[model samples]
Every structure is written in structure tokens, then in C-alpha cells.
Target chain A: MPPRIQIISILICVFLVAYVFELVRRRHLSEEYSMGWLVTGTSMLILSVSDRALELVSELVGATLFTSTLFFFGLLFLMVICLHFSIRISALTKQVRTLTQHVGILDHEKRNLEKKMHQAPWQTSDSSLEQI
Target chain B: MVTPEDDRAESVSYPEPLPQAPKTLIIIPAYNEGKNIGAVLDGIQKHFPEIPILVINDGSSDNTETIAQQHNAEVISLPCNSGYGVALQTGFLYAVKNNYSLVVQMDSDGQHDPANIAVLLEEAQKDDCDVVIGSRFIGKAHYKTSFARHAGMLLFGTIASIICRQKVTDPTSGFQVLKSRAIELIASDEYPPDYPDADFIILMNRNGFKIKEVSVTMHASPDKESMHHGHKTVYYVFKMFLSIFVTLLRKSPKR
Candidate 1:
């Protein structure tokens, strides 16, 4: 019922609502691919608004509730980057597989051509490759 | 203990007609063919009872896997439908691990005649080749294929022949027989998943593997529409040709 508690509660609701809407709007979160960031954000927002925890932590760290909330979000952002890179690594691995296959095919053709040249009546070495 | 005679016998026909014959495995890649998979398997079983069959259920949400299982076919359900290329690759890998001497791939749809599999295997067993493709154009049948599909196939065949530097009649035909050595090489990730018909010919040729086309009968799929859309046909052709160009330009894998 205190004024500070009411203000913190309203702020927590605002942060949680904004976080949920932003995630939905940007299409970052889906049923199948959720990274649990929304849950983390909700928990952080609640903890930041808890008057007892805020008073004790603010007293010890000398930081306001708003700054504490910002810190939690920054941590979430870092986690998102990590998750993104993991997906990218998987995609790159598939690409590397395809590239290796292409390289293999070309190398095989070169060897066949070399063998053909050696069997030819007028054979030329690599130095004279362009003449033929 | 494989003598030259044994090698000679292998190149002659399917099942090899020997007591110590190598096991033959057939892989059918199915996508959304709930109705046709059952009939295809039935016809295959009736024709080649000795061969074990495996169906690569390419992430079909339908009863393809269930029906395949019902027909006593081994099923490897891909987590998602990667494409026809990946489905066949999975089957090739299965063949390699299981030590199958020969692996045959037939469309799960009833369009591909299972009886022709025996014909392909006979040609494949001949010691000179690694890949034997079933060519509808080669056989003396009614050959009722559409002009558009035939044109597409011919174009692919011509491009593949140029890239592989060998004559190829049906590059896009999915039905074929592959030797164990060819299977090991093809089981790798490089095989194209969509429109693999052309890329595979070039891949085999580059690996110093012999590829030959034999005439076989293939009926039109009772189901009219192909899995690929009209736009996808263009995309598939572009990607297939581009990959062939790039593959031709790249170096082969070292032994």
C-alpha cells in the first residue's frame, strides 16, 4: 500500500508487458523456438520490484530498482547472442560439407585429365597445359 | 575370398545366383505418398522377396511411415523433410553401415516399375560399372511420358552428359542400382537433395566410377501432381545446373 511499492509494481508491470509485446512484435519468440528469455525477463522484473529485495540490494549495491532491471536485460541480450551463434555454426557446418564435395569433384576431374594426357601421343606437362 | 570369377559372376545379374551372395537392400524414399507406399512395397516384395527394403520417410506427416512399417519395411524418419537428395543419402548411409553389396533406390510412388529393378541390377552386376540408371527412353514400350517432363529430362541428361563427359539418357530418373563402392562415395553429404539426377551422374564420373543407362519401363504416377511446384521446377533446375558447374570446377577428394 506504500507509495514506493505502488510505483515499483507499476514499473514492473510496464517492463514485463513491454518485453512480452516486443518479443511478439519482432517475432523472436515462438512456441517451438522459445529460448526462455521471456521467463527470465519476467522473473527479473518481479525481483526488481520486490520492495524488501530492492531496499536490501539497493542499500548494499547503492543502485536504484530501474538500474537493477537494466542490468538483468543486458544479461538476457548477451544470452540471445550466444544462442544466435550456435544456430549459425550449424548452418556453416552444412555449407562446409557442400563445399568439400564440390572440391572433391573438381580434383577427381583433374586427375582423370592428367591420366588422359599421359596416354596421348603428344603429351605435355603442366607447363604446356594451355597449349592443348 | 572374392576371386576374379566371383567378380565376373556379380556383373551378370541381380541376387548374383550364388550361395554366398552379398545381401541386396532396396531403399524407397517417400514423401506424402500414404496411398502409394503400400502398393509399391507390396509389388517390390512380390518381385524381390530376398532383398530387404528400407523406406526413408522424408518427414511426411501422413501415414507413409505407418504403412511402410505395416508392409515390413525398415523406416528411418528424418526429423524434417530435407529433400529427396537427403532422403536417398540417408538410405545410402544405411546400406553402407549394414554392409549391403548393392543398394537400389525406387520411388515410393507406384510410378517406378519394381520389375525393372531386376533388370537394372543385372546390368549393374557387370564388373565394368558402378552406377546403372534405368532409362525409360531405352526400352521398347509405349513410353507415354509428357513432352514437358521429357524435355526437362532430356535437358538434364544433356547437361549431365556434358559435365560427366559421358552419354546419359535419363539423368533425372530416380530408379537405379548402385554398387557398394558407389554407395560409399555417394553416402557423403555432397549429393544434391533436390533434382539429384544430374548431380549424381557427374559425382560418380568425377570419382572415376562408370555410369551406364539401361532401358526400363516407368509408368506415370497415378497421383497426378509432382511434389515440386511449377516455380520450384525452375529453382531446382537452376540450383542443379549451378551445382554441376561448381562441382565440375572443384577438385576431387584425395584418396
Candidate 2:
């Protein structure tokens, strides 16, 4: 709305975009997930630099106040980001569950084999003989 | 009418004889059931002495693993709590790997009566079903529960019955006997990770697995608060509805 606020918003958007790119470059974040942050940061930068475009978007969204329109879009962007994180979390949860199950079974089998070996070292040789 | 045993005998009298006794493994999934697991394991051992028992201790803060091992049940300790579904699936994987022909899943909370395991085993041995569920609602057994939980079970049972195209009386019952076919099928990645209740039954049915229910007695859970309590109950209802709805919309899973 004001010139000073617009300048601060542009600065923040620039920093956000740079940080997201840095993360991608470092391979800390995958390109698939970084796309949302990149779009949000670039959109904010564009809207902040162009007052006419902001006013037009506010009118299109039927908001009487420009700040309210910006807040609305910000909230909408946040909702989308939250939804994306939730989907990723769901996939990770499934993967973690599968891994945990396998690990538990394997650990159990290893302990059993160790105990059997301790009890009867000769039994192991019988199995090896059978294999031969 | 010829009895099932007599029919089996008559069939065996022919060229090909009946298959040998199926190797059965009892799997008990325990989570924070340290207080009750010992007695449950003892009961199973007393009644089914020859059958091997395996307990999947689901990363309980208590001494569930110790108690299970002390009772002579093979303990598979999960590194962390991964919920009931994952623990049970771990047991399924173990059964498949060990080449067990039948797997009997019983809770470590002492709710499921070990005496009724024979009923489930007999029903499973009929050779007509891939899975046999031990149901509490079908028999003279009286299992008391909170009104909300009972209502939830009824709701899910109705929905699962409609989707499964069969009468599902106790869709929430966890005590079951799975043949090798069902065991192999569930060991796959399609098994639900959380509450594997009515939605799972529908999935198995859609996958062409024959499911049969036998009446069984059960004791009330020792814990005052169920795993599905106040707010958790609401989330459970929402999650189950979403899961069942999505499952219905998806293409039928291959056998």
C-alpha cells in the first residue's frame, strides 16, 4: 500500500526467493518441493513491484481493501503449501512404516540366529554341509 | 449331512490324500501391554503348547519385550512405536518368511480368548476361506464396550458389508486366522499402516480373498481408555471414512 511497505515486501520476497534457490542448489530441498516456494516468492515480488496489477487483482477478487486482498492471497498460498507438506508427510509415513516393519523382522531373525549359534555351534555346520 | 471331517476322510480315501497338518504360528502384537502380556502368553502356551508364539513388541515404553520373552514367546522388538497395523504386518512378514501355512493373530492385551483359537483354526481348515475372523457379535459371548465405540463399529461394519458384498458382523475384530494365501497377500505393501479394520476387510474382499467369520468369546480390555478415545475417536471416524471412500474409488487390487 505505502511506498515504504512495498519496498520492505519486495526485499523480503527477494530474500525468500534467494534462500529457496540456495537450498535447491545445496540439494537440501528437491526441485519438486521447491517449486511452490519459488512460485510464492516470485508472485509476491511481482505483485509488490506493480501497484496497478495489485489493484486489478484486488478488484478481481472482489476485495474492498488492497491489504485484505494481499492477506487473502497470502493465506491461500499458505494453505496450498500446507496441503503439499501433508501429502509429502503421508508418503513418508508409509515408507517409514514399511522400513520399520522390515527392520524389526530382520533384527529379530538376527538375534534368533545368534542365540542358536551360541547354543549349538555344530548345528551351523550341518546346515553348511547340507548346502555343500 | 456328511461332516467336514468325514468328507475330508472320504476325499483322502481316493488317489490323492489330504495335505499334511498345516504349520501354524501364533502372532501376538503387543504395544504397552506389559502388564497383561505375560498372562496372555501363558494362556496361549497352556492351551496350544505345540504351536509356536511370536510377539511383536511395538516399541512400548514399558517392559513388554521382557515380559513376552520371559513367558517363552519369541519377541520381535520394534525400534519405535509404529502403530498396530505395522506391527501386525511385521508378524505377517515373519509368517511368510518362516513358511508357516497358517497364522493366528491375537492381541497381547488378553482380550482375545485363547480357548477359541481352535474354533478359528477349524473354520480355516474347512478349505473354503482364505481368512477366518473370530467375531464377538455372532455368538452368545457378551463383549461390553462404550456406546460411541460400539456405534462406530456398527457403522463401519455396515459400510464394509455393503462394499464387501457379504455380511460383515465384526469388521473391527482384530483376532483372526489367516491361511498362507491371505498371509502372503497381506505381507505386500498394500496393507494399511494405521487402523487396519473394516477398510482392510473391504480391500481383502475386493482382492478376491474368501473371508469367513466364526463366533468367539472375548474379555473386556484391561485398559480404561481405549486406543480410540474422545478426540482420537473423531479422527478415527474421519480417517476411516476417507480411507474406505478412496479404496472404493480405486481400481480393485490384483490378487
Candidate 3:
């Protein structure tokens, strides 16, 4: 790989790591989800800076060019991160659904209690709402 | 037209009615159904004045909640637009929480006639049936549907029929009645979150619940498409298959 491209790659990795850290500091990104990105950024920085590491990765990946090997690993990292996000999103969707239901139920229960307060115990018809 | 009054069992003739306490609760899950909710509530109210009606409003942008409230029906408005299954599970949760002995869940659309509530109740009263499904394809319902939907319904109905060893014609029918045990089970984690159609019926059957399908007539939905339309139809089919397979894979939560 040309020194120019390696310099650019190193700068990008530094920027990625700095941006992720900034996001965590500002609370835009939580540490739980940022771990993958941080690790990927750090690994990319190391791969770019160290020629020995870059050569070994290129030979292991059977890539003629060092840059292609870097690109392959970068792409692989992105795919893994995307899959992780997808899994998190699905879990969050279920959680949100359950939360929404509980909110609706609680609201209804509050209203029922208020309505019951106004009515005499004998007059209220839906008195069995609590036994279950 | 079989009206709710026709063969509507009175409280006195309930075949061992529970001490006049409100045992039966009708749960209506509605989403953007302001147009027909009033009439639906009125029809149910007219026939069964004693039974309490609760409507689970799925965060409709329309005046569905207000209309349901105006009809003197208990309304549980979800905070946001949720699926029909979520709205339904909410109703089941409410029923289970309230200790209602019997729960009749029907569609919010005008398609399901309030008159058929009695039909379901009668079926449950006759035997130890935990779930009474009001089948549209049975007998002389004459309910019309799109070709794709009809095919899907037939496919699942056939699957359910074979498994349950009963003639399950309407696996997708939303108009049905559930006893407390059935209601509690559906509301639990065992129930699928999205479209709870054929898989749920089969799940109940596998769990040792007696499911009875009674012939009931339903009107064709006018100016309204099914909830499983467009992209949702594909997802519904895929989810239906996956959930059915999953239901079979999992062990019974309750005997």
C-alpha cells in the first residue's frame, strides 16, 4: 500500500474512534452499543499503523494488495455491527410493545378507579375487574 | 338476519349462572373504527344490556376512543398505533386482571355482528369448551373475501383442522369467545405478538383446551381492507408459518 493511502486510512480510523468517544461523552451513544464500533476503529488504526500486522492480515486473507485486505476486514466489521444492531432493534421492538400495552392498561385502570370513586359500590356494575 | 335477541340467553337461564355478578365481559379491539363503533356498541348493548363492554382502542387518529366512550363502553387507548394482536392481548390482560369468568372478543369493524355474541356464549355454556370460535366459513355465513386472503385462510384452516382433529374452517376469525383460562393463556408469553390467527387456535388445542367452532354469519367488510394488506400480507404469511412451527416446538405452559 502507498504511504499516502495508509496515512489517509490512519486519519479515518482516528476520526472514527474520536467521533465514537465524543458520542459516548455527549450521551448520544451508550457504551453498550459503542463497544463494537470502538473495537473496530481501534483495530483499523492498529492495522493501518503496523506494516507487519497489515502484511500478516493480507497473507491470511489471501489478498494480493494490503489495502484490499483492510477493506475486506472493514466491510466484514460493518456487516457484523449491522447484524448486532438488527438483533438489538428486534429485542427493543418487543420491549416497546410490552411497555405500550402496560401504559394503556395502567391508563384504563386509573380511569376505572376514578369512575368507581364517583359511583356507589352497589351501583357500579364492573365490580369484578380486580379479582383476577 | 339472526339478531342478538334470537336465542340470547337471559341471566336467569344461564345454565348455572354465577350469582348475578358480572362474569361475562365483551372485549372489542378497535383501530380507526370511529365510523362503525357506535352502531356496534349499540347493537351489543341492545341485546345484552347487562354485560359490560370494553373496547381496546389501538391509538386511532380518528375519534374511535370518543365514540366508544360515548357508547358507555370501557375504552383502553394504546399510547401509539399498535397491531391488532397487541390490542387484543391488552383486552385479555384486562379480562384476566378483572377476574371475568367469560370473555367474548369480536372485531371492531361492522363485519362481525353483535348478534353472534350469544351464539359463542351458548357454545361455551354447553360443555367444557375453553374457546368458542365463531367460524365464518361454516354453514351459511356467505362471507366474501379477496382470493389471496381466502387461499391463506383455507391453508391455515386445513392445517388447524388436521392437527386439532376437528373441522377448523375459520382459523383467522377474530370474532370468538374465550373463557378465563383461555384468555389468561393468550395474554401470557406463549401468545404470539403479531397476527394471532391459526397458530393461536392450534396452540390452544395443543394445550389441552376444548375449542368449539360454531357457525356464525358475518357481513362483508364495506370500504375497508383487511389488516393484513400489501406488505403486511407477506409478513403475515411468513409470521403465521413461523409462529405455528414455534407453537408446536414449545411445550405447553399450562396443562
Best by TM-score: 3
Select the stronger candidate by DockQ from 1 and 2: 2
**Per-residue C-alpha lDDT of model 2 across residues A1-132, encoded as one tens digit per residue:** 888878988898999999999999999999998999999999888888899989999889999887677678777888999999999999998888878888998899899887777587566565775575
Off by over 4 Å in 1: A1-132, B1-16, B225-231
Measured with C-alpha atoms, the lDDT of residue B66 in candidate 3 is 97
What does candidate 1's lDDT look like per residue over B102-165, in tens digits?
A: 9888888787777777678778768999889887676464456667677877887888877777
Worst 10 contiguous positions by lDDT, candidate 3 chain B: B5-14
Question: CA shift at B84, candidate 2, in angstroms?
Answer: 1.0
Best-to-worst ranking by lDDT: 3, 2, 1
TM-score, candidate 1, first chain? 0.43
For the second chain, the TM-scores of the candidates in order are 0.87, 0.89, 0.91
Strongest candidate by DockQ: 2
Docking class of 3: medium
Per-residue CA lDDT of model 3 for A1-132, tens digit only, reads 899999999999999999999999999999998999999999999999999999998988899999998899999999999999999998999899899999999999898877766585655445554442
DockQ of 1: 0.02
Order the candidate numbers by TM-score, best to worst.
Answer: 3, 2, 1
- Pick the winner on TM-score between candidates 2 and 3: 3
lDDT of 3 by residue, B153-252 (tens): 9998898888788888988788888887788897897787786688988899888999888887787766486656544677878888888888888887
Whole-model lDDT values for every prediction: 0.72, 0.84, 0.85
| Interface CA RMSD, all predictions | 10.7, 0.7, 0.5
